[model samples]
Target: MDIRNRLKTTRRNLLGLAAGAAALAIVPFAAQAEDGVLKGKNLAYIAFGLQYEYQVTLVNRVKELAAEKGMSISVYDGKGDPSTQTTQLLDVVSKQPDIILLNPVDAKLLQGGVRKANESGIPLFMLENLPPEGEWVAYNTFDDVAGGAAGADAIAKLIGGKGLVLEVRGAIGSGQSEKRYKGFHDQVAAKYPDIKVETLKAEWTADNAHTLVLDAFTRDPNVAGIWAHNDEMIRGVVSALRQINRLKLAGEEGHVPTVGFDGTPLGLERIREGTQDADVGQNPFSMAESIVGEMENHFAGKPVAKETLIQPVMIWKENVDSPDNWGNRVN
Candidate 1:
């Protein structure tokens, strides 16, 4: 053990330690690079329609998230037409994007397209809607049934569970619309026996809802409350009431309590203004996150849940200002 040999041994050990540390650091960076599998991936999102504020927000959030992840996304508006959506889905499948995200206007009508995507070997992800027959990597959607039940409970409480409440229903063949209608009816039947719901088909449009509400009020002036499947339809209800001089703020005498689904900015604003009661809110931002996360998982060869249901939030005047409410965060 000479002094020179001892010095050489110590220096060699130090070099070895430094090399090990450098390799350890490289490991993490390599893993991080692997985790970004979504980068440069192409995503095709077939939205149910961009006509509604909620759908628009959902599409925008997805786009933003995709951009952040260095992924590219193409969005197609279904225009609220099932046949058109079916055509678009087929066309998108032919393009052979890395992934396909479908928000169907009618689940049944889109099953063929879903099958086509499956046959093409393209991974399919569903948002806010699901078809009976399909092979989807993951499906992310809000609990429409729960949202409807919440709306029913809110309206029943406001109306004292005894009166003729008008229900502004959405499109006939839409799965979400059907679920909401069933949930509202079932909840009312099970809990609020004295409440009678009169149905009006609005097709998820403000003008249709406005016309229907005006006709209903003309037929019966004693309608107690209103529950709409969406905030857009509620807007129609508001205009019709105002035109007839029946609109009143909450706590005012003869104020008709209103409950709506989809916590759009208008819904939150009305809640703040005391013109609306409650909104069963489906967070589009959250839904976008869930779906995009699942897409990343699929690309990374990680396990993904077959279905993810983001719970609805009950937003009322008391909590409309909460930052967590998607309505408040929308640009």
Candidate 2:
């Protein structure tokens, strides 16, 4: 079978196992933190899937931090199923974890789960994308809108504020995607009015992005730059450009400058090779570390910020290895 199919199958298996384990276990309130470290302090990490490399990195970071703090982390991979996530949340709620770190499939649909956790007197640390509404102990998010704006601004600067811009948006209903799109458009409207924007949704996938780019280029040949919400989509966008032998054709004169978010290895490689223009890197490792700290503080009856914002780095060849750069720290 193909890679996608294999990935899908693996995700299904993981999800099934996670759901079953959660159901079988009847966890009781084991123990709370004495000093800084919480012994047997239960924490639930509910994710959509472990298929994505970012997700794997982030989850592993959480596990690492938990191990350091003497906390127990029970994970739930929903296998891209919202219903399964809801069920898992219910199971996690029954276990009565001290904290619930959630990355929801749909922000709006997760309101009930958030509410349930809250009603159970559990602190919630929402990572990355947020729910549509409700209060959590901490809402950790990157300035995706700013990242998008920055990416767009970078493109505009490269083209001297005048060019045909092609935008590769992420999946619909993804709060980060929406924010990124808004940021990009807002920047374009303010800083580069001479530049026209044409957007196509890539559904947050490289393959979809490739297909979308191909279609966009078919209609508009003079697409000067491509700004994607995620690096995965950016890779797809580049793949599409390369496939049509239009990689050199889409630039200002003859080279299309591409910018993306999530400074993943693939995107970094492109940046190193002088193909991808820039990427916004959010340090998931640091975020995971912070979450553990907050959880420890909460267990110790100390105050923690209800909302935490992590500054993202604009990564390029020049700043790739700078002290402030976010490398493979997620590992």
Candidate 3:
């Protein structure tokens, strides 16, 4: 049997990809935290990089929620360095905050930190971005494979299922990078045989993505669509297009349609302007709220779910401005 036949991307499968983050779970049962663990309590959010727009958005949301609760989570920026994140995680663990929210820079590299958090008796929440899968205290995630598949399907449809598609992937060795690319390529190889995709590493940086796109198109201008793993990379792709004077809106004679993940306000606006075609909206805001809400539940001696699954939302120009349809804030 052809391997591709066995590996098919179904609507149902693609729709629920994020469920796997905590899906096959036997989360170790633990006693909930004591009362008043949330309000006025110190919660440390160890972020991978504050420079990322998505990370910035997460921090901003934390602030908004914190102000209302009369408490704030101490935010630590890893600056995209795995070692820094590991160091920060240990430092945060030493303080023994009421709860810890970790966005691991690199799951494997942060194992030591994970072990420390696990040993600290403090509740650790992996919101949206999951760590190397095993037993987690609590986790909430977007359907990443589903998100990637959605972008693939959109690009396929936009290019009429026939053309060269350049995949601008994120940092290698990361779970998301692998899963997102897998979902996309698997769908393309299975569902849209006529569509051909070429990949280049961007390391999830805009500069690298910008150069990668420019270089790819420079080598092959016949490319029809681009699938960026994140919206920041999409910005780089846009820059490349603008420089080559090939930047055109959707419906223009020869605009190379593109799709991206991460529903940042800027990204959504680009979609609204018809520069970017579609976005697989990862609901990090909701993911954050869901995971953190567990603090209160735990304080009440209630069992928090092992995993909270938030489905991916696909945004295009048609519904970009609809307040209710947003994955993140519109503004």
Clashes of each: 0, 2, 1
TM-score of 1: 0.89
lDDT for model 3, on a 0 to 1 scale?
A: 0.73
Better model by lDDT: candidate 1 vs candidate 3: 1
Best by TM-score: 1
List runs of model 3 lying over 4 Å from the truth: 1-37, 133-135, 325-331
Residue-wise C-alpha lDDT for candidate 3, range 119-186, written one tens digit per residue: 77777878656666434667777777887788888998899999899999988867777889988988
Off by over 4 Å in 1: 1-35
Ranking by TM-score: 1, 3, 2
Worst 10 residues of 1 by lDDT: 24-33
In model 3, the worst 10-residue window by lDDT is 21-30
RMSD of each: 17.4, 5.6, 11.0
Q: How many backbone clashes does candidate 3 have?
A: 1
Q: Cα lDDT for residue 322, model 3?
A: 67
Ranking by lDDT: 1, 3, 2
